[model samples]
Target: MSLSYENYLALEKYIESFEDKRGSLIIILHKAQEIFGYIPEEVQEFIGECIDLPKEKISEIVNFYSFFSTEPKGKYEIMVCLGVKCKKKGGYAILKDLEQELQIKDGEVTKDGTFRLKSVNCLGACGSAPVVVIGSTLITEADTEKIKKILHEFEK
Candidate 1:
């Protein structure tokens, strides 16, 4: 679902707060995701309009970033790390356990709208290689039991 023009305009005002020298695009995109729940193509276009950049340029930025998602996400999105370090550290096993428990594949949302499972490259937490990020919160060294507890919290 897309926000109305008025709401998008309001988001523009909100995005302005994130404009600074350091990684402004990523910050704005995060804010947009906070507002819209997902970074759809329209949101990218709106971001471009707000930042006075072309849609193509914004699309490029979106494509370049693995953190940004163009599709709708569940209320609690579960991001599993599958980077080299993470994979070698049992991250994939944790993800497999979660997929079996949730009965959903990677990149798919459950029918109940509680969770969406996604495999991400890295969380920059190589020390905590088997990391699972629920929404914006990171859970390092998460096992199946820990993941279950986390999902229970979201269900409530």
Candidate 2:
């Protein structure tokens, strides 16, 4: 989606607020994401012009960080923990089930934009291996049936 002109103005003002601050590029990028939902190439270029940094450098930073997204995200971002413990506990199976249900693979959003599925390395909740995170709510000891029920709640 194209960002509104007003949103671009907001981002410019935000960047100007941190012009003199050291180590503020990442911070600015975060704010830009908040304003634009995702940092597309155009946003990256705009940020580059605002900060006088090359777009390549900004792109590298965005790419290095998994938190920054270049594409629009669904309202519910479903992250399936693929840490060693979770993986052993059937994490891949859970991911596959979500893909089948949502009809989208990892890092993809469903057609209706309700959900996005992603497989992350760890969520730091090994005690509850096989965890699934939807927004801020964590579903521990997650199984397909349980997840299906939770997804249904969002569908309604």
Q: Which number leads on TM-score? A: 2
Candidate lDDT (C-alpha), each? 0.83, 0.91
Off by over 4 Å in 1: 1-69
* lDDT for position 146 in model 1: 84
Over 4 Å off, model 2: 1-6, 9-27, 64-67
Clashing pairs in 1: none
lDDT of 2 by residue, 1-156 (tens): 349999999988888787463379989999999998899999999998888888999999999999999998988999999999999999999999999989999999888878889999999999999999987789999999999999998888
- Error (Å) of candidate 2 at residue 106 is 0.7
* TM-score of candidate 1 against the unseen true structure: 0.59
Clashing pairs in 2: none
lDDT of 1 at 68: 76
Model 1 lDDT-worst window of ten: 14-23
